[model samples]
Target: MMVLDGEELDQLYVDPSWQSRGIGNRLVDLAKTQSPTGLALWTFQVNAPAQRFYERHGFVAVEHTDGSRNEEREPDIRYEWRRGPVRP
Candidate 1:
């Protein structure tokens, strides 16, 4: 994963064949331990599963983009996880 001094979680990926075995969750937990203050990330808008996963982990969509800044030109959403309690 690409973390910027424990502030931003730039990327986290698990091979499709190895998914659903808790690897992604572990990685996210590690990121949280490293960056207890908070963490932020972006996922493509078309990726519903990813959005759900992040939401389950306490991340909330905080922003949106029209795909202009990314190489893939895909619309994306930014999610953020704050330090304390998870939102309900």
Candidate 2:
């Protein structure tokens, strides 16, 4: 996982075979710890599983693009996360 511009999360990936195994959870948690104020990242629109994963981790979809800004030129969604209220 890489944090860009001090607050953007990039290149956060786990091998497909390694997915659904909590590695993602750990990485996201670590990202939160490192970027407690806020964090943002983009994922292809076709990656529904990734979108769900980030949503479960408290990220909310805030913007979408027609693949114009990225090199791949694929439709994408942007998600943002902020430190929420304490649970207890």
Candidate 3:
């Protein structure tokens, strides 16, 4: 039940022990139904694994957003998915 910007999915975590069991995929699928077009999320620029997962789920890198907040910040990447069509 976590949400962001009233239109995004954030911090979707499956227990480390449950990793790779397709639980995360299922949750993402569920979230898609509730989202407009589809979901969007941000992950650390270094998290290649997560970026791959999102790509498998049909997300594409739209841009990179500021990771700054009063000095405690890190680079983050923004990804988005469209349940409809992808514009070129």
Q: What is the TM-score of each candidate against the true structure?
A: 0.88, 0.89, 0.80
State each model's C-alpha RMSD to the native.
Answer: 3.0, 1.7, 3.7
Give one digit per residue, the lDDT tens place, for model 3 in 1-88: 3354545887688888988888988878878877867678888888899899999998999988577841448778899888876579
Find the number of clashing residue pairs for candidate 1.
0
How well does candidate 1 score on lDDT at residue 55? 98
- For model 3 the local lDDT of residue 33 reads 74
* Candidate 2 residue lDDT tens string, 2-85: 445667898688888998888889988888888889999999999999899899988999999999999999999999998878
lDDT tens string, model 1, 29-51? 99988989899998999999999
Candidate 2 worst ten-residue window by lDDT? 1-10
Steric clash pairs (candidate 2) = none
Error of 1 at 62 (Å): 0.3
CA lDDT, candidate 2, residue 57? 89
Best by lDDT: 1
Model 2 residue 29 distance off true place after TM-score fit, in angstroms: 0.3
TM-score of 1: 0.88
